[model samples]
Target: MDDKKVKILLGKRIKQLRQSFNFTQFVLGEKIDINQRQVAQIESGHSFPSLSTLVKLAKVYNCEIKDLFNYNHLEKEEKVKENIINIISNLDKKDAQLLYAIVKVIREK
Candidate 1:
């Protein structure tokens, strides 16, 4: 993926997971020892986090670091196939290709 796409993907995933646990930017920042603004930037895809910050976030959120990024592409695809075939069928070729690649990597693990 391109740099912009990667950033957006990571940011969206972080935001999704953070909200899933009912965490505010301030609360998550406090747990990770960063300011809320930094958390905002992370979730907004305006900045990239250092490895240490990523680790801290993973720890604070009680998730493995792998959960912070786009590792769920495969799982999402499966869910779509099982539960949302129309949505999956609507995806363009590029998206399907990307999903296929992610599924391949996930299966390898």
Candidate 2:
């Protein structure tokens, strides 16, 4: 995969993992000594974390660093949709409702 795709997949994975742990970007950043903005950027796939940062994040999430870069599952568009569904399924009803509305609006455009 291209570098941009790698960044996006990694970002999505990190975001899903972070949400599963109930860690806000700021809280996770604090735990890892990164700024919240950096976390946000990382989650948006706008910035690729350095190797040391990846190690810290992997340790925080209790996974191997290599697991963070597993791109096979992320290669499919359906996998991306599935990941989004998984994330939304974990959210509160109100947020999910809002997201549904937003998705409807976007799809209608």
Candidate 3:
């Protein structure tokens, strides 16, 4: 992906993680030792965090730096579907059945 796209995806992933932890931008900023406006800028894709800031963010989120970039869910739908199909095609029969059951349960919810 291009730099801009990557930044946007990273921003989305950060926002997702922050929300999952029930943190507001102000709260997340405090935890990461940044100001609320800085957190807003980062989450809006208007600014990129420095390496040190990334480390602080990872620490606050209780995840590795790599997890901050795990934005596969932000990819194009067609690409996501292709990836899912490829993964499913490679799964063993038992794993496939397990995956099917999990998906069914998720759908029922």
> How much lDDT does each candidate structure score?
0.81, 0.90, 0.89
Winner on TM-score (1 vs 2): 2
What is the overall TM-score of model 3 with all chains considered together? 0.68
> On a 0 to 100 scale, what is the lDDT of residue 98 in model 3?
100
lDDT at residue 97 of model 3 (Cα atoms): 100
lDDT of 3: 0.89
- For each candidate, give its TM-score against the true structure: 0.62, 0.68, 0.68
Expressed as tens digits, the lDDT of each residue in 1-109 for candidate 2 is 7888889889988988899999999999998889999999998999999898999999999999998877566567657788998998899999999999999999999
The predictions' CA RMSDs to the true structure, in order, are: 10.8, 9.7, 7.9
RMSD of 1: 10.8
Residues 1-109 of candidate 1 have per-residue lDDT tens digits of 6776667668778888788889999998888888999989988878888899899978877888887875468446546768766766889999989988998999999
Q: Supply the global lDDT for candidate 2.
A: 0.90
- For candidate 3, which ten residues in a row score worst on lDDT? 71-80
On a 0 to 100 scale, what is the lDDT of residue 80 in model 1? 70
Candidate 2 clashing pairs, residues 3+ apart or interchain = none
* Model 2 misplaced stretches (Cα beyond 4 Å): 77-109
